[model samples]
Target: MREALCQMIERLVREEPGNRFPGEGGPYFTEPLIGFAAADDPLFTQYQTVIGPFHLTPTELAQHETPPWQPATVICWALPISEETRRSNRTETIYPSRAWALTRQHGEAFNSALRRQVVQFLVDAGYQAFAPQLHPAWREYPDSPVGIASSWSERHAAYAAGLGTFSLNDALITPRGIAHRLGSVVTDLAIEPSARPWRDHRSNCLWYREGSCGACIGRCPVGALSKEGHDKAICRGYVYGAVPEAVGAEYGVTSTGCGLCQTKVPCEGRIPAGKVSPLAVKPPEGESPSP
Candidate 1:
């Protein structure tokens, strides 16, 4: 099932034209990395404190369809932005590049469609599946201390699924780095949970570990980031305010995005080498590092 899901994502990115850059003519996302977690994983409960009490559990979500007795699995994935998009955003100091703005808008359209496709696939396979983000009950509390937090955080789900860890910018730093988007589906499929290689949630981030790389802090033109961490309100305002307008004027599309912090950093496309904690074990020969 894991192989099948991975193949499906690869095919979707390769075949979906909407995943392509508007005029740059390339896929918005490279191949995605997928992972799984037990729906009842205690981590989900901990997230309630970290995110909010409003966070939904898989069993709660499963009750929306199947009976509560049914077991569930959460499938999460990291969709890394293409090098083209990453490169373009890296060149910008303040706002996102036109290519990135378009990718942010259109790429998300593809992501939404992909979520539906995955859910349908599971349903067709005789399992009850739902994307919490797609649920009518889904909502975001933008005023939360974290800023723009949702009932179902894809980054958190991805972490539970062993996809990645949180970065200084609060972006999920997968093996493919922070230049990526994430998605998830909760289902009664009961797939084995992926192994989380790191012990701590912020283990993969260099800034959180060695405190040596704060490139993302400098990348924020609005000073939304600092040694203390990110100021989500300021960052959100910049991305949702003047940045989109400028990008729209240049690209002829009103798309809001400012990923300057995600690119031109040590963790842009891969885990920063030599930054892993001393206690972290190297991957066995012939195996790729966890994402």
Candidate 2:
């Protein structure tokens, strides 16, 4: 099933017309990384507090089926943005580039279609599948203490699926890096969960592992990111607020994004080597070494 699903994702990125940019004729997502986890994984239950109380467990989601379901598994995938798009945004200091804005807005539409397609494929194969993001129950509550959080966090699911870990910027740092998006589906098939290589959620991050490399903090144009972590309200205001007001009118899109922290950094496309020693380079004044 994993191999089949991998092939399906490859085909979608390579052959799907909808995944292509309007005039560039290139794919929005370069390639995708897929992982699996048991439906009853305890981490899902833990996510209720980690994300929000509204988060649903696999069993709770399965109950929505016409006939109650049993044990299941979750298939999660990460879609890395194309280098061209990342490069475009990396060159900007204040607002998102046109490519970045389009990817964040239209690219999500493609992601939704991909989710629907995957669910349909699983159902057609005699298995009951559900995409929590696509479910009616899915909801997003802004301005939470934990930044802008949602009921079902695709990045958290991807982490449990062994796709990657969280970075200081709060983006999922997969093998392909933080400039990407994630999606997942829950199904009745009990597939084996992927191996989680790290002991802690932030183990893969250089800032957490070695207390060095706080490039993301410098990349934040609005000063939303500091040694403590990211300031969600400020970041959101810049991306969803100032960005659209400044560039949305010209781009013909309402939704805007800024991924400066994710690019022009060592961890943009892949994990960096061992951490830099604190003695070699000290963090900016007033900023701590901790991520």
- Which stretches of model 1 miss by more than 4 angstroms? 66-71, 275-291
Q: Encode model 1's per-residue lDDT on 37-77: one tens digit a residue.
A: 99998888777777777777777666666344465789998
What would you estimate as the lDDT of candidate 2? 0.80
Give the alpha carbon lDDT tens digit for every residue of 1-291 in model 2.
767777997788678877888985677888889999888878888787676667788788778767778747889999899999999988888888898888888888898889999998888888888888988777788855566877788888887788877788888888888898789998987787897765466756788768888999998989998878878889888888898999998998998778889888888998777744212132123221111
Task: Please list the Cα RMSD from the true structure of every candidate, rounded to 1 decimal place.
Answer: 4.3, 5.6
* Model 2 ranges with Cα > 4 A deviation: 143-145, 275-291
Q: Report every candidate's CA lDDT.
A: 0.80, 0.80
Clashes of 1: 1
Instruction: Please give the lDDT score for candidate 1.
Output: 0.80
lDDT of 2 at 144: 57
Model 2: lDDT of residue 41: 79
Report the C-alpha displacement of residue 178, candidate 2, in angstroms: 0.4
Candidate 2: lDDT of 199?
Answer: 41
